[model samples]
Target chain A: MSTPYVRRFDSFDRVLHGFLMLSFLGLAATGLPLIFSDQPWARRMTGILGSFEVAGWLHRVCATMLITVFAVHLSRLGRRLIFQRDFGLLWGPRSMVPQPRDLTDAVGHVKWFLGLGARPRFDRYTYWEKFDYWAVFWGMGIIGASGLLLWFPVFFANVVPGWFFNIALLVHGEEALLAVGFIFTMHFFNGHLRPEKFPMDRVIFTGRVSLEELEEERPSEYARLKASGGLAALQVPPPERWLVRLGTVIGTTAVSIGLLLVGFILYAVLT
Target chain B: MRIKHWLAFFSVLFVATLTFVAAKGPTNIPMKAPPAPSRPAVVKAPPEPANDDCLACHGDPDAKSDTGRRIGVDPAKFTESVHGALDLKCVDCHADLKKTTDFPHPSKLAKVNCAGCHQEKVAEYDRSIHAAARRQSAGSVAATCVDCHGTHDIRQKTDPKSLTYPLNLPATCGRCHGDPDVIKQGHIQIGNVSDLYKDSIHGKAVSKSGLMVAANCTSCHGSHDIRKKSDPDSRVFRRNIPNVCGSCHEGIKAQYDNGVHGIANGRGNDKAPVCADCHTAHQIQRADVASWRLDTIRECGTCHADKITTYRDTFHGQVTSLGFVRVAACSDCHGAHDIHGKADPRSTVAPGNIVSTCRKCHPTAGENFAKYDPHADKHDKARNPVLFYAAGFMKWLLLGVFGVFGLHAVLWLPRGFRERRGQAKHS
Candidate 1:
């Protein structure tokens, strides 16, 4: 078998990705007022946020951040495609495609859950996880394009028909619902709600694979890494800088609290 | 002593003589009847009693006719009535019944007419067209107490079974006016006037508001003396139109007097729009609903068809079809009851006043654009060239966008899902 490369995301990529997620959360929080204007408590929230004008400004700022992250990420991807010629990174390989063997493996995994079979031969990434990643990209593209049009209505009015506003409203609302549903249900299950992960996973933060974790979770990637002598090169020194460590600790705590509050408020409002 | 003896002897003689005179005196006088009236004149029949109750003093069939039961009504039935329950009696209305049943029936008994008992209400009713027409037509279907109030069975209006009860009066009056046989026999024009009234705004509001002043059958037509419309003395006559309609619409009438429609029509000028011209007298309705407004338009279009046709083709009309209800109607700008020609100073549609009037419903309407007459139709020349083309263009544009996006959502959404699935499989 050919050796596989295991390159960890650099610090800049990790921080930028974190900023993108944070900005996304901010946009969602502020823009939701338009969706929930009729709700009684939403009135109070809008009032506190200084009515529609302020909410609109906050949404615009978050959108700007999101666009910035998108541009940076796109440039990085372009560099990889042009200089590194890493097109295979996107498609991975024929093995990445979900196959009939995946169904068998999935069944075996379920059986293992029931203590009936050994853990199935999961490759570098599970089919469900792969599905979620692509859905995020699809959702972002549609929602972002529609949102931009809505944000700059006067500009769009010159080019677009007035009727497009109604359509944009429908798409934006539906896409938002889809994004929220997936993030809460599927993403939560794959990333946070698992028995091993429980509340969260550290992989996204450390951006490093442990020897044991790699062996168990992605044995094939681990095997290829060993062959290519890339495993030793993949060391991240566990965030040795104290300020960075403390900052991460505080940031995670704050983000988690904020997320929990958002979830609770959403629950109260919906129910 | 001698004087006392003599006085005793005299007293004995006196007693003997007095007893003899007393026994003879009454027998000697003759009995004679008192003198009657100097010239005997013929007497007329007595009048009916006015008391709400006829049974109290007269309940006994054998009750003395000379005194207590002088005024005659059938006491047997009266004793059984709801009036009897209240303990009212005949002697209350027939105040002089005990004195005499002499001819001319003692006007002292309050004359016993319903008008006599209810003078103020009766006087007001007398002024109505109904009363005047009845008087002029001379007993032509002239309504009296017995027509509305049953002769003996006149229950208090509070009783649901009474003819005057709110729920039952319509049917009660409809009995004569609505009945085909009755109408035919009475030479009355036949229609479901009552059914048509139930559809009117006044009829609905009378029921909802429970306000007695709201138009009921008796309100438009005088209660006691409904008159024919042809009578000039009638309240509904053209000369008396403003006063009759102004009873409820005083403010509108005052405004209309300064308007073009209120100008005199005889001196070589064309006829002005009167109350009935715009708002049909009996068929008046609230114009809030689009259907009602459209009906109003059609009514106005009878005289102003070109304007209506143009109005129908506007953007406002198109949005109305799209179910955006807060759109403009004729009355939205034009005063409803007090409409006038645009030249009149008091007219709502006059150039100086139209903006404020339009702004009542359309807060965003431009001031200069408001005065531009929406109803002016270049009758056949593709009316309101700018507004017509613009509204049409917008309508189609909106329709197209909705259609395109709907199609995209239907076709591309699933395609997008499939493509994402393919990408997921590859990754």
Candidate 2:
């Protein structure tokens, strides 16, 4: 029998994630060549994109999309807190926010990886997942702010000192490199390339997880939901085969592009 | 006494003979003298050969000299010539054959003297290097009048068929200048300048594009009195190059004259750059080309070594170094012809004007944005301490993150493999 599914993310969240994935990949693909413009591959890539000017336009368009996704995601959270009065999102087992339990889980998880202790039972969001969430927040502030300064340097010159441009240039490039490196390698590994999820984890795309997967991955949350009889409310019919296939295609394409971009970055940095 | 008496008588006879000859004039004097005594004696003038008389034998298609050299001149081409159109007689230049009554004259004749008619031009050529070389060497084949202008078929310089015409002048000069054998024989120091000019912007304009105003060999180097480049009066001489080029590029010359380099050059600073120093002489290319623009950075660096070194550290310099021209280059900020000291009010990079200069690329650039030092050197702590420390911090931060995370990812590979193996075993 097909295992029953549980809705982990709403459709809105899934669509926002899709936009985030696409825009981030677009930004990295276009921006990396500018940073490493001296490389032959950078020239070739820019040529493929028509010209450096086109690459620049593509980068700014992608940046706008990313900014839109960030704004929309924030507004949704704000609506939940203000209108729906859902304060549980701010602090709880299901919260994206870091709690004291995340510290214990991190230490325990590392210990388990080292074979010195049993694996930690993650409730809903693991420490790494929380880290990824907050990293985006930090990335948005630093990279986004600096990028705006560079994009509109003349306008910003009135407000800031001239030396600020040099500093902004340095900060924008370095922080972007850090963000791209983190997302492509660390985030990819944690989200999909781990032993259990060696190929991919499509729950983000399909917006649902099988009951067996939820039980195995987050046993504590599963147990809590069952005891409170909240599991019935979250339960759903199995995701359609077509939906799963669509998610797989999208998920695989994004992963492949991300990995390919990472390969280009490595080639540029190494040579 | 007898010898002395005879000597005196002979001297008196010689005087008498001289007096008689002076009074009688020549034996060929015309008997029909002027009726008035005030009119001078009219002596019979020598018979001259007409153009047709010379052309009778010389115009034959197979006419040859005693030594079997072709001595023929085509009548059709001669009729169209400047001298022929003027109806000049053959004896006008061949003055030695003027009085000759013989049907066939000597095979060898006196060389035609072009200076007889073109005295001023010949005087100028006399002072030229070619004339000097001819005077120094016995058998020197240095260019002469007939070498450039055709002997019988000479045409006006304005005519397109003229050798000295603007369009054909390069090839006329290139006959010797471009010939490897001639260059070797003449010990020419500057190699194949003709070939170099053929590929240059001016040469292509004149030859390929057929631009009448484009400079040729005779434009920079004067036609009649072309001198050695070392001669201060030579148009191509170092100090005179600006004026020579300025004759064509009036506006750029005006701007350059007001700039620092021009000012220095005017002050007799030989080291100060002139037009040829940067753009070169014969191999000059259009400055708008990407390769030329990139190359001009190094050309400028030839003088401003420190400035170029610092410029190379900037984002603009780095991008340009990679062969991209989207960013600003040295001349983009400094101004190509009107470059000045930063303190100068007219300078593009001056304190008051820098903001507007930055606005050329960044339309909304304010004073604060203009403060960005494009030539800031991170290694110089005293001058750029902020940049120095910031560059240092970023360097370590990148290395630290990559080092630690790289190590973590490396260690995780083994663990990941073992976990996967265990899962496979279970399955």
- By TM-score, the best candidate is 2
Task: For residues B5-42, write the lDDT of model 2, one tens digit per residue.
Answer: 45534543454455456666664322222121211122
| Model 1 accuracy (lDDT, Cα) | 0.57
Worst 10 residues of 2 chain B by lDDT: B32-41
Off by over 4 Å in 2: A47-53, A84-88, A98-123, A193-196, A211-232, A236-241, B1-72, B82-152, B171-212, B223-240, B264-272, B277-298, B301-329, B359-366, B376-390
Shift of residue A255 alpha carbon in model 2, Å: 4.0
lDDT of each residue in B1-427, candidate 1, tens digit only: 4575445335434544544556555642121111111001112234333232244444445545544444445654554444444333344334345244443343335434544345665776677544554677764564555667665456666677677776556667776666666555455553667667766777776656665567667655556555555556666656566667778878888776655556553221335666766566667777566555656656666776666665654434433332334567666777665667789776777877876786686555455335344553333335345444434444554355345434423443344355447556876
Model 1 ranges with Cα > 4 A deviation:
A1-7, A93-117, A240-271, B1-427
- lDDT (tens digit, per residue) of candidate 2 on A1-271: 8789999999999999999988988888888776776678777888798866787899899999999999999999999999999998999997899999999997787677677887788998998788778877778787788888878876787788888767777667777887788788878888888777878888888889999889977999999999999999998988888988988899888888888888988888887
lDDT of 2: 0.81
Clashing pairs in 2: A154-B365
Model 1 chain A worst lDDT window (10 residues): A1-10
lDDT per residue as tens, model 1, A1-271: 3233233556688788688677767776765545554455555666688655676688889888888887787798789879988775566522334556566765675565555656665666666566566566666787788788776654565566544544455466556655654555446545654444445555555565456656866776677767879777875455335644654674566456455535644665677
